[model samples]
Target chain A: MTQSDLTILSNREIATSVYEMKLGGNTISIARPGQFIDLKLDGFFLRRPFSVCDLENDVLTIIYKVVGRGTEHMSSLTAGSVLDALIGLGNGYETSTSGASPLLIGGGAGVPPLFMLAKALVSQGKSVTAVLGFNTAEDVFYKGEFEGICSRVIITTADGSCGIRGLVTDALTEAGDYSYVYTCGPEQMLKAVWSKINTSGQFSFEERMGCGFGACMGCSCETLCGAKRICSDGPVLYKEEIKWPTPA
Target chain B: MADTRVTLCGITLDNPVIPASGTFGYGYEFAKLYDINCLGTFSFKGTTVLPRFGNPTPRIAETPSGMLNAVGLQNPGVDAVISYELPRLKEVFFKPVIANISGFSIDEYVQIAAVLDKEVQVGWIELNVSCPNVHGGGAAFGTTPDSAARVTGAVRRVTKKPLIVKLSPNVADIAGIAKSCECAGADAISLINTLLGMRIDIKKRSPLLANKTGGLSGRAIFPVALRMVYQVYEAVRIPIIGMGGVAGTEDVLEMMLAGATAVGIGSANLVDPFICRDIINSLPAEMDKYGISRLSDIIGGAH
Candidate 1:
């Protein structure tokens, strides 16, 4: 909630419509892998929430897509501009839940956070396997980083332009024998993963959010118990707790 | 060790930071991220006598320096809230919870308030007579002083708890509406729910939001909200909960100086869930930085 004029450490296109920016804010130094920061972009009222892509020292890395007005304005920001950001938000993933043999799955922009999760697991002497998904080779991101940390890294694209042709689930199917799974992606792909995997897994769900913390119930999903706010209770939820929206 | 406490309508809150209605969702979800009780108070989603599906999706659209939403007061209705939501709320929150009630008619307001008044956990009742986003319902009741007064007077007859009337900013004379609510027995008034706006997708060649027009909120609306609050504060004898596009403690101080007894943070909470908590923690230290003591002492003192 602290406000700071963060200098752009690096803002560059990592994939088609996807970008990575390194911001100099002290808040970034304390950010965990799964937590996010809301960047107040030029000509936008609500700050855009981006997951902490990577953090080192005072540099906070955020990878985002130019999906709306906020990100569109963010894309036009140059190298030296100072932006106001609300950093260190939401509950990041807990490593204790990642078993000795764990599989990580990420799709599109979702692949960024898994890179940090892989690094954390490798440091703990855990065997890590990752499946990174993209729609095409140009859309693919974070291949080298995952390769550096995980024992095996599988890449999948919808078009036959990259690693394994087809979806991320196809890539995951190729690499088996995982004790636990951690995934983040579009709801449909997550539902596919949920259906195929019998093992306990952690998932991150995206919703049209207002007040990304617990304040607005705008981003709510029904569960067996009742409704839960996705931003606070989770952008991350245990697989069993999630009640998917039935297809229209 | 700092003093961050304030009193709203004689009800003591640990701080003046309340998560506005439609934002805090009864306080359970935020409780998972941090202690819910740490907040001054939290207002629940607007509850009506009957269930509501809300407006159509593509319900939200991003605007320059703000966003537009047509989330037409979606709730599981008042009875479901009392039966289902309240028990869950009691488990997660210990702080004061204000029930924000909305209705299409006068009797609906009374029925909902009467139900909430019996619940000891409900510290106050906030009448939502001023949401501009909904059709045939919201902005209609709020745009006219007579209708707003009628609704308030009807609810006042049934409820004993302190009542806060949330005013719509779309009205031409907000001061008249404030007077109407006060005359109708509203204990306090919260002004400037989202202003109405619309957007069209250039490529799709159609309105971006399904509702066509929606309520505008965020930093862009701050000035408009402040001006309305100042006008309404001058006209109303009761307390004012000023809200529009409050992003920080500085904005909070500005609203208070404009004569708001307390302020509400709406869309800013979406950007950062920890904002209320951050503002709460930073207030005293921020006040100290300005050589101020009590939050009340700082209110309306800005010249």
Candidate 2:
């Protein structure tokens, strides 16, 4: 990963409590689709980690929610704000392994990373299907964007104010005949996705991290191969290697 | 020209900046960022006899000027360190690395220390008597002078290499603990291994860290660590590896004046992976600005 000062080209709220920020910096470090960036905010002690939404030339796009003080402060920023960022962090998605038809599933904040993956799959001439879930119609974002690239785009809202009235699984039957599944979302949603899909896939996981690199061991995840670090070992993991925690 | 050389336990380090244990991992991550040979030496992750998965998710929390982590000594165990980590560290780091060992009992410490002492890559065996994050193990021996001394003496018997007992600051008398380790044959004392602290997620109305509490480190702990280093300096005859929130070169120089023969950069490495390299590159200039020519002369200068 490379560290560079990125200039915030735009910071605007895209959906309810969610934002889409475009930063201008060196895209040289970003190699894969699912890799993230850890940003050092001005007054925060720990860096805020975000998945890369899109990378066009030198301008990088990221989506964040104002869940806490850090992202709230991030939402207040304007153009020309310089942020010290650790670019191209975490082991991102392995797109080459994506087969003929890829099923990209995402929920809420998890939707952003799939945008880049969708773009990648489309460029590879693979027909892509995107299943996105949100709390409501207002919480929905990038639906049109995903529709523009994928052969089919499915939207699910918990409140039924949007597309299908349920979780992304409620709309899964319509997704129909996909070769691979790539998903990122809340743990419960991810767990559901893990059990519902029969196809081989990759999953993106999140944990409270210490050093967004591999040093601190704060973001350890248990897998079939013992425990691994989520920051360096992965924010993404193969579906076969996943070992979900037994329910209490 | 500013001189940044210092001798710790008869071994000469090019500089006094050592990345604190648990912060630098096995020198693998930072090696990808910049050349790690420039660092004096970094203390690797806290290794135990058997592998530990550590605390659960949300193992960390952010506070003002600092962060709290309950990593609970998560490591690949001693065997993996010898077989995998040390070999990889050897490839990138040319200097001898410090092995920071943690254990639940005296035998565990003795076992791990004995094995590491045989490795040529290990320069010193840093006994982590004070890892506040783990339960019934890590910080247990460090909270008391007798326990700290007992662990130090046990490890000292196993390894002829210089022994540095890392002391926790959560006790009543940090100096007493340092002196006890010194009297027990410890070659040096690394003070202030994170004060136990915790945070609450108001939104969830529960503790932020999975372990409930964690060791606090960063700018917030600097003054407390400095005071403890200054206190421990007057109590122990051995050298002091002063740490706890040492970020910049000024902090390094300040730690030296507080009686640290060598300084450690911990959470700062998490903030900026290249901080140690940058500090070493700018040490001479920062020293020049302070009218100091040789860093060795400034050891306990404030005293």
Candidate 3:
């Protein structure tokens, strides 16, 4: 990972509490789709890790939800602001694992990384289906962006305020057969998807991390393979290796 | 150029900037980012007799100028560390690495120490009595003089390498515990480990971390660390390795002046991966600015 000062090209609200930020700098380190960047925000001790939404030469795009103080501060940043970021953290998705037909599902903020994944899958001559899940129609984002990249895009809102009602699982059932499934969302949603999906896929986990790299073992999760660091060994873990603990 | 070398228990380090345990994982991970051999040496992750899965999720919380972590000594155990991690560490870091070992019981501590003492790569055994994340043995032994000495004496019997007892700052009389460890035959002392601290989520009306509490470290705890280091230095004749909130060259010099033979860079590593390197590189320049010629000359200089 390379740490560089990235100038904010734009930080604009796209959905209710969600924002789309475009950063300009050396994007060479961000070599893969699912890799993330840790941003050192003003007045915060720990850097916030955000997944790469899209990349274009020298520019990097990330979508963040204003959940806590860090993202709240990020939402207020103007175009000219510079952010010190450790770029290209965590092992990105292994796109070679994707077969002829791949199903990509994302929930809320988890949708950002899948956007890049969908683009990569489509570019490789793979037929990709994108499913975006949100709490409501008002909270939805990137439907048009997903449509521009993937062959088909499905939007799911819990309150039946959007395309398919219920959840991403509901949309997954309607999306039909696929050779591979790649998903990222809340743990509960990811586990639900893991139980329902039959194909081998990769799941990106979100954990409270100390260092967004492997240095700090703060974000370790026990998998079938062993105790793996969620920040480095993953933000992405293969479905087979995941050992979800019995709910406490 | 100013002499940055300092000897800890007769072992001379190239510099005094040792990255604290849990921040620099096995040295190879950071070696992937930059050359780690430039460091005096780094303390490897806290290891135990058995592999640990650590605590549940949301194990970290960001405070004002620090962060609270409840990582719970997540490691692949001592055996794996010796068989796998250390061999990998040897590839990137040629310098002797400090082994930070933690356990829930005295026997467990002794067992881990006995095994690590035989390893030629281990320059020092940092017996961690200060870890606050675990329930039974960690900070419990550190808070009291008797228990601290008990663990220190037990591990000291088996280990031939320099035994540095890592002290917790959560105790009421930290000096008393340091003196006890020194009496129990500890070769040196390293203080202060992260302070026990907590934060609550206002909206959720619950603790921010899943573990409810965690050890706090970073810039917020520097003064507290310096005071404890100073106090411990007075209490014991053993050389002290000062840490907690050591971010830059200035903090390093100040820690040395506070009676640290060497200063450990902890939470700062998480902030910038190259922090230890940056601090080491800037030391000579910083010393020139402060009219100091040798770093070793400043140890307990404030006294």
Candidate 4:
């Protein structure tokens, strides 16, 4: 919510296409788990949105992928660089309402936000089972971070280059008794989870956005009730409210 | 007290800066970051009669000093908007919210305006007569003076609210279209929607966007936007909402001096969410420095 050009505390690559960056912005320091910051890299017209990985004091940690030009420039910056960011966006996950033994699913870029959710859940004396998905073994990230906070941490990769060869759903062992499920990933993966589990959950979708905030209706999702903007009402939506488009 | 007040088309704005349609969703998202009511007003994304899925993938591409978009007016039909977006917009923003309306036909424009006419929250209707990126439709209506007049006239009959006709920069005779909108009963004219542009993938040997063409907006389009605003201002008596590549308060001032009653922050909003606020905050000081008290006193005063 507050805009301050903070310096980079540290920027290091952890896995393929993934890097952990730390900034000194106070706005990001107070950012909740599910909230994201829109970052402006040099020479790009639009700011890129990144979720808060961790925060302490004036320092803000974010794990990001070098997917496009913006991130590519973000990757090249040194420790002294400054970033103009719109921090504290989207309503984060509500921890108090979540039931006991919540099932957490995160794929690739989606994994960063769940770290905070896991920390929040465990602090409240609740058991969390996290399933982290990546494309290949080398691409895996935050396995250690999730393991530190959760009772059970499962890892999945499509090529069998890592833990389970199939997908996050492959790691859904035991009965479908999870109190609530929270997931973020590519559309196909979300659809898979949407179909397999009839239980209630929360979903975060990625859409091409005009303004990372709600001004542009560029990133709108059709819900069961009606249409809602992902940037404003939610990048997170209750499972029941979503009307997943039938694949053409 | 902050001198955060501006008037356009005889309508008073709390401030002159606003997030352009398609950039600021429904005025709710930015409300989370800052008090949205602190500024002038907000314009919602384009609405149509039927829900449009928008253009295919690669709908947007960033070019040097600008960006291209082929969004294809993706919206949840006008009826759905009145039922869904309007109620939500009413809850979040207290200022006037301009509903941007687009259509494939003249009747569609009337139908959409009629639906909006019933909603008192809607402060104005911005007609997208010349969207260059759409296929076969928008540019056609915008390029011809007759077509622009007909569309504006049709919508004018359905609503008593202020009508602002958005112009396209692709046309050669922009003044003709501006005059046409004025004659067609338009209350005001918003100029320079986007210029028709294309990009090539040197490595892939194909066009960059799936639509093969897109509307270009950003810093590169400013001069063109200013010139068109000047011409249109001279051609018509209606107020002009100038937009192209406004990034700062200085740009806003320049746009106003060139005859823009208000300015639209397009690509600049994408780069910095605080740009609009920066312009709004610095306007009074800028006026003081220039020895001017009222923004209207300097309208087209640069010449």
Question: Which model is ahead, 3 or 4, in terms of DockQ?
Answer: 3
Q: Model 4: which docking level applies?
A: acceptable
Decreasing DockQ order of the candidates:
2, 3, 4, 1
Pairs of colliding residues, candidate 3: none
What proportion of the true contacts does each candidate reproduce? 0.49, 0.89, 0.87, 0.35
Indicate the residue-level lDDT of B76 in model 2: 89
- Computed on C-alpha atoms, the DockQ of candidate 3 is 0.87
For candidate 2, list the clashing residue pairs, or say none: none
What overall lDDT goes with each candidate model? 0.81, 0.92, 0.93, 0.81
Question: In candidate 2, what fraction of native interface contacts survive?
Answer: 0.89
Task: For each candidate, give its TM-score against the true structure.
Answer: 0.77, 0.99, 0.98, 0.85
Worst 10 residues of 4 chain B by lDDT: B1-10
lDDT of 2 at A56: 90
lDDT of each residue in B255-274, candidate 4, tens digit only: 88898888888877766766
Model 2: residue B284 alpha-carbon error in angstroms: 0.6
Candidate 3, A112-139: lDDT as tens digits? 9998898889899999998889999999
Work out how many backbone clashes candidate 3 has: 0
Number of the top-ranking candidate, with TM-score as the measure: 2
